[model samples]
Target: MNNPIPPRAKKIPHTLEIHNHVRIDDYFWLNDRENPEVIDYLNQENAYYKAMTAHTESFQKDLFAEMKSRIKEDDSSVPYFYNGYYYITRFEAGKDYPIYARKKGSLEAAEELLFDCNEMAKGHSYFQMSGLSVSEDNQWISFGIDTVSRRQYVIQIKNLVTGEILPYKIENTTAGGTWSADGMYLFYCRKDDKTLRADTIYRHEIGTDPSQDVKVYYEKDDTFDVSVYKSKSKKYIMITSESTLTSEYQYVLASEPTAPFTVFQKRTRELEYSVSHYGNHFYIVTNKDGATNFKLMKTEEGKTEKEYWVDVLPHREEVLLEGIDIFKDFLVVSERSEGLNKIRIMRWDGSVDYYLPFTSETYMAYTTTNLDFDTTILRYAYQSLTTPASVIDFDMITQERIVLKEQEVLGGKFDKNNYIEERIWATARDGVQVPISLVYHKNCKKDGTNPLLQYAYGSYGVNIEPYFSTTRLSLLDRGFIYAIAHIRGGEDLGRKWYEDGKMLKKMNTFTDFIDCSRFLIEEKYTSPVHLYAEGGSAGGLLMGAVINMNPELYYGVIAQVPFVDVVTTMLDDTIPLTTGEYDEWGNPNEKEYYDYMLAYSPYDNVKAQNYPNLYISTGLHDSQVQYWEPAKWLAKLRDLKTDTNFLFLDTNMDAGHGGASGRFEALKEVAKEFAFLFDLEKIKS
Candidate 1:
């Protein structure tokens, strides 16, 4: 077969000037989604990708099947008791969607179907149903559906007892609503049509037209987004407006749906906090008074002002207070210390305090599903690099645990003992130690001849836990070593770790990843000729920046829905996440941030140099990162790069940020990615 020629995007130079800096973008014309020429160009690139990899079609199919075979076709999640019923989400054999059901009082009771997503998704190419909220009486349920993949859901209600759907519908919502204590009204957040930001909170009375719903509150700050939810105590409905560095909350009595909401605290610059209700006080986790790692405080129900707050747990510099779960007798706290997750169990009366024991240093553990506040049973989940995920229920009094369910890896070929999982630290250019979690087959060697794939997402304080994956088994069995680099941009080590990697210090994220790659090569775990790197979204930005800095360090790279056109995207506030992310990427309206971002913006930094093999993907309907960012970046690379190495752009026409709404359908995307790596390595089954 002959190699296919890559698509050449027509150049129409468009000049943009901001902060006294000028840039000439030749492919700026591709940003218009409504233009037929833009669609034609995307289709041409799609065809080029198909033609270039046509020989790997069979291998890709087999790879997809191999990965899919490891999954249990008929599986149900562990049912949890909530509001007099046990709710379950189960998948049927050979189906694309899950079936949501419930049983009254006990698991042995007759099941009542809530939503058969397979049936609901029969006619749509893309489908998603989320934010399922059940009324207090259990006679009604509310859900949001999005068929276009843009995440703009339409909310609807259904009568669980009569099996009749409500006539009213709410559009352009954040997909879920909070039901009032009397179940008479629903409170939901509304999104702006253009930017897709949730900026308003509204209340909808049951059996009334949504157009007549009352606007309860509006968030005037463009940098902050709003959301509505019921307190865990079920006594108050909360409206929270939050930015990256600040937050403010309001609340109203759940029993009085028409009552006005009272402000718990006014928004102060750089003051970040969250509220939870228990008995007669509201518990807060906050970063007040320079508590960079956050601290727990409590205030009486009527005295929610900051002046009335008293310390429950004072600030600790080494530990990050992630969150808390409230109960009548006990308090569960989720914390992170020394790049590891810890779950602490403490009684309200201050008689007992302990932490759930975890054996692996590189594992992830967190509390889950303790909705009933009166119970002594505490449910949590645990997973490691080699171990499958397991859900365990613990009795707070007896210190006993029951394993409710463990993820079943089918095909009879999986054994935890066959793999080695460990954590290793690498010194960065600045002498800071970065953690890397690695897993490989026991038979693999550290001879530098082995192929290794390193991945990281160093942004938004998001920590990518070292968890098990059934899909990753294919790589391990194929003699591939997989690694997760716990770099500085994430909150892996604590709040300071994230703060040191953002704003003017953003370059640390890129350099830390490069240092980790070099460390792997220096340790003989993998050579530069066999090293592969992967990251998506902000992590994709890391991929772009590192390759620009040191392209020869990686043999191949996969960037999924990359946010490469940073400066341009940040300057335009009309984009979905631009305005709200000013603190994240920095406000480019300032000359200092503009110069710093342009210095590292991947698309702006493309130049004449030898490049590695690249596989880039995006969705046409992506609301978070526009598809044009990747399209334009690829065009620039094709025009400038001097190498003959392959560069492919794949555009998913039917999906959004998250590709393919189905469970099995999403696997095909992974298969394509794996095939790209295998083909480059000349590995064929």
Candidate 2:
């Protein structure tokens, strides 16, 4: 340990021939998780990382404490009325997890605890719960629990009145369950064990053994995953099967649990739509008929076919129809235009409709829990880079909006007025305008000497909204400019924005991010020597790409659970998310896509060049982007790169894609990241 040890990965060369092209992968042997050599190498990397950052260990703890102090440990969420109960999630002081409880009728009633995650998570290192579905009669509750951090869960029923756990437990589920109206049966989606894909829907009768559960529907397509949920209207149990590009749905009457589900629409390539049950028809948001930005359509209950569909909100060339929350008398639609999200509320009778106005130039407003369909009140949450998240209820009848609660920043020193959030557009090489959302301390100067951390996730149409984060205060207070690059791959601008950033045009996403960085540098926000970059998962792909393309442009980079070895990962259908992402990253089996992906694929494109100081992180049990991708990428970079810049890997042996499950424990990783950046910047404080 005293000899300045660095893990020199043993290369066992493996040749891969695809489309008549021979590629040599020297670190292919690292993918074997069971091999002791692999574990030894990873542990050595961890040891080296710890030794390298030992000087910042004290700083890391202080950063963690500073971040934790900003969060109110005993805070409770705003309760929302649902099914004759007011559901609330609150945390207890000194605890990591929350207590999910509800009141029978009013908030003042005696609290009935549904699940105490602190108690259930005591013995496990990783734990998560989902699908907390209460029965129609409120006598039974079904929930999905995952203890292994692999996204696979077991569905268990509980008797609320007697406070007893039921004997029936459905295993290998997707952590969701839909309870029928009569509470006689529960429907859940089952995952394929090997792929961890939710591919089948099953029905389990109350009081029956799980072994007796019936397989109601099977999604044989490897590229599609299935999910089951009861409609907000509570009249139908809907089952949806979807991939990156297409979606199909089937539904059954909630009162008739044994009845077969009828297909709402047949599946078609590149056609994506979602359904919501309403009075006598199903409201759908679809991208069919070349509606690139998508539009709203409605169909009769029995004649639920594409041909019979009629437009409710006609396709707009500019506005992207994101989603809709249906109510008895009003429909709240979430739409995006010019890279900003807005909410439009329309009355059922088509007499009144108007957009909800926001005061911030860059803010995120989305629908929260609106379980009651008959009410005039609409619940939504809003937040900006400078503003704490606020839970709001809007009255559709009177157009009055009430802020129920604004998140309390535990430390009294935090003031929204002391910060400024703004939006700017950067021009890409192709002349496409890329939007940038940034926030900084009001006292901070727009100087090129300031350190800037830019983040982006441009894949699978997942738009990275400019949301508030309490943990980010550490960086802002330290004079760091935090910016989000709304690059092309995401649906930030419109559906066309995503379409131009994927498949053959995928390079747009990478170059757009680089362009944004250059623009910031030119604008005096930060210079290349003071710039740092970060991204996770697919966004991590952006991090790897930018560093490879312009290594001298960044002072440091942090990639968390990165999907770096794209060409290799996509070539293997055995990977959990590979098959389902064919439409996103494109299938490498095709020669056209193979050449296009390899041109920018991070691992394959690692050449002998200088790279910025890097801190890469991965979870050993990550199912989404296998840990081997980043491990292989790191080994290759360390061997080929000519620079002596710092390169470190931190692997969580007991975690998965989401990292540590505990609230406080996850902050340690963030602290380590901040400490790494701070040390590189010579910021000892």
Candidate 3:
């Protein structure tokens, strides 16, 4: 952790390949182990806030409290029965605890549920895998819990009428389960991951035989993706995943768990599917023409009933649709326009359209909907630069909107009101347009000299949109500009966009990010020397690419639990997330594939160059990406790089890819990141 980063003019050394067993004892993994002087410096920072001056935890508590009040009086909602209560972990006394709140009829009784995570974990430790559902008649309640390993689970069905609980313990991975229409069939998908390659879908006749002796017709295979959807008494299972891209379809009839599954018929390589059933028909949306726009097709008895189009915009990139929400005859469709970055809702017959304005001012959004026959409640929550996120609830029928919550900053200290969301397009060396979303305080002198932190993740068909964040408010409020570089390897532009950024075209994602950084400098948003970049996991690759390609252009780099040794990880089958990702990253076993991967693989491409301030982090218990990749790479950088901005290794001993065990812990990590950036850049004020 003491080695200084090497300058771009110095020669870079090749990383040594070693059979290092990655586990808990690595030196980089530790908590609260900062330099004594640094600890003293941090304690002095407590004059403002205790947890850390980098994060305003006090402000956050006040914000959540205010948000709770806002959730009240926001009456617009969807018709279907939904559990209005959600439980979250709270830190009280000396232990982590669980709290819940229930939304009673027309009144949200937001009271803390008297439950503790420690107590819950004592009996049912796998609360993360727990499931909750109340029967349609509100007479029966069913819930399931998992035991860490052994793929074991216990399903408990309680009779509210008699207050009797019948629990069954089974050892198998339950992909999903639902109650049948007549409440007779308890349909669930169970797979023996220890012995079998593919999981089978099953129908258990509750109160009859245990889960082992269940019925599975035409047993589902492992090659395709299968998902079970539940809506009241309706039970529908969709199985896709046959082709490289799986499109979902509705399952009408039950299949035998003992037999093999039938091959899907109407599947095309160019198309993907998602299904929903209502009114004796299954609504199907297909992207056969392109990954952007979709054609809506409704089918009956596994046959097409009528085919039509929704959100029919110009190209695939312009029109992005979710599904056909059917309510009696009227249908609701949601559309996401890529170019404009706005969400719009329309009817099944393509009539009565309304746009749910996209909040371009935030970092990202987590959207959810609660609906029924007549009413629909849409909830969108996000975070931005100046403004901490506040949820907004929209009533579809009356079109009435309510601000569910806003962070009530203590003493009115933080306000992002003057923040602006500017969409700037940067052209890659190849002339491809890479969009960068920026959120920064308005009155912050535009001398193009402020510190700019550009973050990006260009892999795994994931999309990073603009959403609100209260924790990040600490940074933006501190005279920093927050931005997200929407490059490649994300669904922001659909499947083709992802396809172009992965495998052989992997370099495109890196170049696109580089272009974004360069464009920011050209636009006078910030000076090239003050520019900072970051990426994690897939995005971590982006960080490495930018740092190595033009280290001098950036002031610092934060690569968290990165996959730098791509060629090695892709070849080793023992690592998780590799075999399945072969489609995304080429096979290193093949000579051609190995050569292609090595071209951009950080380790292989390392050479003498001026580098930026680098901070590398990893977790020991990462089940997805191996921690060894970064551990070994950092060791090489120590022996190779030839300059002076500290090269730190902050590896977590007991964490995973998420980097923390609790919610606040994650915020602590964010604080450390901000501290590192602020320290390296020597930011004023």
* Residue-by-residue lDDT tens digits, candidate 3, 1-685: 3322231211233343333422122222211224453333222322222322224444444433433332222122221235443323234533433332234343445543323345655553223334544554555555555434223345556565576666564446443456655555555555545332224556666576564446444334333434344642143444444334554343544323223433333555546766666765555677655545566665564454223333233344556665445554245555545533444555546655786655553344444443454445556554544455666776655667787766454435555566676767788898778778888877666678878889889887677866666555556666778788888887576556778888889888988888888888887788776788888887887787777777778888889878887876676655554555666777776767777777787755566666787777776555555665665566556556767556666666556676764334455566667777776666433
lDDT score of residue 620 within candidate 3: 56
Best by TM-score: 1
Question: What C-alpha lDDT do the candidate models reach, one value each?
Answer: 0.94, 0.92, 0.58
**Local accuracy of candidate 2 as per-residue lDDT tens digits, 317-389:** 9999999998888989999988888999998789998999887889999999988888999999999999999
Q: Which of 1 and 3 is ahead in TM-score?
A: 1
lDDT of 3: 0.58
Clashes of each: 0, 0, 34
Superposition error at 434 for model 3 (Å) = 1.6
Measured with C-alpha atoms, the lDDT of residue 634 in candidate 3 is: 60
lDDT winner between 1 and 3, please give it: 1
Q: Candidate 2 — which residues are off by over 4 angstroms? A: 1-3
Residue pairs in steric clash, candidate 1?
A: none
TM-score of decoy 3: 0.76
For model 2, give the 10-residue run with minimal summed lDDT. 1-10
